[model samples]
Target chain A: MATKSVAKKQVETPDGLTEIRWHGRGGQGAVTAAKMVAELALGQHKYFQAFPEYGPERSGAPIVAFTRVSDEPIQVYAGIEHPQIVVVLDPSLLSIVDVTKGAPDDAIVLVNSEMSPTELRKHYGLEGFRYYTIAATRIAVETIRRPIPNTPMVGALTRITGLFPIENVVNFLREDFGKKFPPKVVEGNINAITRSYEEVQGE
Target chain B: MATTDRDILAVTGNEATAEAMCQIDPDVVCAYPITPQTEVVQLYAQMVADGRVASEFVTVESEHSAMSAVIGSAAGGARTMTATSSQGFALMWEVLFVAASYRLPVVMTTVNRALSGPINIHCDHSDTMGGRDTGWVQLYGENHQEAYDNCIQSVRIAESMDVRLPTMHMYDGYVISGAIGPLQMLTKDEVQQFIGPYRSINPMLDTKKPVTVGPFDGLHGWYFEHKVAQNRAMDRALQVIQDVADEYAELSGRQYGLLDPYRLEDAEIAIVVVGSTAGTTRMTVDKLRARGVKAGMVRVRAFRPFPHEAFAQALQHVKVVGVMDRADSFGAMGGPVFLEIRAALYDCDPRPQVLPFIYGLGGRDIFPDNIEQAFAQLEDVAKSKKRASSERRYLNLRAD
Candidate 1:
């Protein structure tokens, strides 16, 4: 049976709320990235919600997570059918899932890809949405010594959307990661974020 | 409302409830690991190990043993608690009645999930709905904030001297349990003051006042009387629930009523629902209202001691009402919520035509359009002055 309602037409999201959907695989920090956006919103005195569309819990499986940031309290608990921003944490998911499904024509689609935005769009025959691309996986490997692209994707999303200042996110990550990880690991993630922020390409 | 000082934090429903549990710092928490609810136990155990709480965390073998241990601890004059979902809740079936009958205020967080034949771990109310008559006071929350608030208030409601019955607050499994949402939190000092000290009644550990618990109530025993008394406490609980909620509102600046009615006063058509679906329904109501439809919603926060009077009063003005239930009662008149609501409106002077809608079972999504269709049906019922059918209808269910 189909699990979600298929939107036949554009559904307007609630006023003053920015809805975002994240596409990634299990064990790739997509859920974590979704939650980090919420935490960033909390720091701005905005209300936020982040939740994953949970299927079977397994590594390497395709996963989707959602985040909503609003100036007012968020009351709706439905899955985001029309996200204003769609972030692709894994480039491999682009082939299997329509990451842009249900999003508006003007929605910002950010992907962690080595190709430039124009080249990536042409390569996939993508249209109608503004695309932003970054070598997020390469950046993560170079700085964080890992292949997880979620943090770098977050940095690119921040730069592409201009939701908040890059320095603020840096400070937030430092304080947040400082509590959980060692100094080296925190610094590595911070480097990965700033590098991705500077290298992301969009028109 | 008082201007209270509160900390706003981003946390999942499980994390929020765990924080509440830590703040309350009960004497003993006996729980086993179960999905959706496992995080509550895991987080609370971390707190206990980290010395953030003084509560004794007992890891039991199964949900049955978890409930059994909580009963024993609460009977022995300890403020006890537990958390479970779906199959875990089903496993606690037999011991649930014993905890309620013994009049122990054993507070529990039952993250609502579907019971399994095909072994699904998703959001549904079948688990809690199945235990509706288990004699436990049930409170449902729409999201993480309400779950946190309900968790804190449940202690006071359950431990009320006049109404000492076990309480279980529920939220949609995974939807709320694993979802991170912003919550305004009371400090540890504030929580401790709000709940006050735990008072133990007929303590088995008390040397001077010796009491026998779980005694054999044979054919000549006051078993029926005991049941009546239990029912009386449940009846008294309605008031206690309100009183505690009122007090909580004063301290937290967030108001809660037995029924949360939105735009229902002047509504021509309305929907009555529970849990996270209430949020989605509210959005639908807003959307329909924008298009000049007099749509409204009444979300039932308190399910057990099922707020019949409140429901009737809130929905009496509407011409048609649709009752949404996440769980179905096999071969019944309709779903549990629908039956209760239909019965509640029976004595109305101009009784509204109520329709039954079963939706979102086994974690099926009920989007805004589906709710709009329900409201459309209600409109049709209002225009024709006829019932849609004698059978229960479904939202977003596949016919094929």
Candidate 2:
């Protein structure tokens, strides 16, 4: 007899889970973003899991990190083979890696790019899929005075999935940054998140 | 202060284990940086640097010196801990037995990784399995939460009166070490109160009662008796492990046991597994159960004591058993876990047909499908009442 005693939870999203795979360089915070999204989901009382695929890579080498958000305990610990959403923190990774390798046709593909999603869809011929583009790097540079797009991409992710309220994401950032950085640095990241949340476009 | 919030945080297995270390606040933490295991030390070092913990953070040059330094501190009656993996653990081979034999209650977190020849840095039980008989009580974790909890409980288990043995807790290198998951955090006060204070026995620092540690044994010395005493401590550790786990459950409301048996009540075919792969095995078992197959899993949480009686009792009803070992013992009849499981059930009146499967070596990914295939093989064996075709089986292997 199976003991099914898991306390059911109500999350903001449908389908019970939103598994995401993030593609980025070693120095870029794809792993950090994956962790942050998992934290955001946890803060909202949802179950989540995140992890990075580590290789013998130097600073600029390509990497992949994965995150899974669910209303129930996640049992899968293997690497993500088929993600419901693929978020590319590095647009340069597109040419080399198959960013949408095992994604279903209706999977959402979010990229940190200067080009619009419609143009990106036309360029990549991503038919029968949801494509999103956000100028996260530009937003980060404008607000945080750096090129790290992870924080901005978090904003875009929250906005796109509606997984958690943007305020909750910002509040998590505020607490996380407040512990490590000064108020000004925290504000810079908050602005980056809010700006990208407003500017993220999808088709 | 004391935090009663019990808020869940999304954290990597390394980060969660380190947080438990910080909360425990040992006297010394001596560790060297190594892949997979490096992040645990790095996070703990940051905690020490930021004054979150008073643990004397000793940055050692090599894994050997790291274990040596902890041995010295632990002998000096200081609560000491460290973290290492793979080759680093291989480097600390000489001192591992020394720590255990000296009856030092030191705790070490071994992020399980493959000992290298091809220089791979991934999840496997090779390193810890290599030191299986080093006399330290070994606890394996199946997820980030278990990793965190084991780190905290290792202290109390090691320091227990009846079991003054050094303890090593392990989780899969990249799978649990690098994976991020949500886990509840106990306040600093809760951990401090749970672990309490460390009481030293035969401490080197007590000049008035000066005693020798690691003294040479002559031809007529009681070295044989010392070895027997160590074995006694290991046997005593089983009870201490259960006691500590029970108390921890009362404090956190989350209980852990020597073995995690899932859907095994009336199982005809079952799999015995360890570490993070058990999570995958459970999912596969659930899927098979849905199809009217009585598939079950027993995840061995405590590997050192082997939990022979508990395991034998759990497998009483099963007709076929599959023992999954992530690390293989070359030339041996079966893997380390398989050998132990077979030995545990040796005296049963009607023993189950046990099959040994070697898998996930060098951090190879074992998906749910691979686990299902293993269960499928077990189902066939259960149906036929015949032994599996191969003496040693390898799962998820690629053929050229």
Best by TM-score: 1
Clashing pairs in 2: none
What's each prediction's TM-score?
Answer: 0.97, 0.92
Model 2 chain A poorest 10 in a row by lDDT = A1-10
DockQ of 2: 0.66
Candidate 1, true inter-chain contacts retained: 0.87
Pairs of residues at least 3 apart in sequence or in different chains that clash in candidate 1: none
Judge candidate 2 at residue A136 and give its lDDT. Answer: 90
Per-residue accuracy of model 1 over B1-400 as CA lDDT, tens digit each: 7554466888999999999999999999999989989999999999999999999999999999999999999999999999999999999999999999999999999999999978888988999999999999999999888999999999999999988999999999988999998788888999999999999999999989999999999999999999999999998988888999999999989889888999998999999999998988888888898999999999988888988988888988899899999999999988999999999999998988888999999999888889999999888888884566757889999989
TM-score of 2: 0.92
- Residue-level lDDT of model 1, residues A1-203, one tens digit each, is 11134334465877788999999988889999999999998888888999999985698899999999998888788788889999998888888999988887678889989999888867887766778999988999999999999889999998988877899899989999999999998999999999999999986
Q: Give the runs in model 2 whose Cα sits over 4 Å from its true position.
A: A1-15, A182-185, B1-5
Worst 10 residues of 2 chain B by lDDT: B1-10
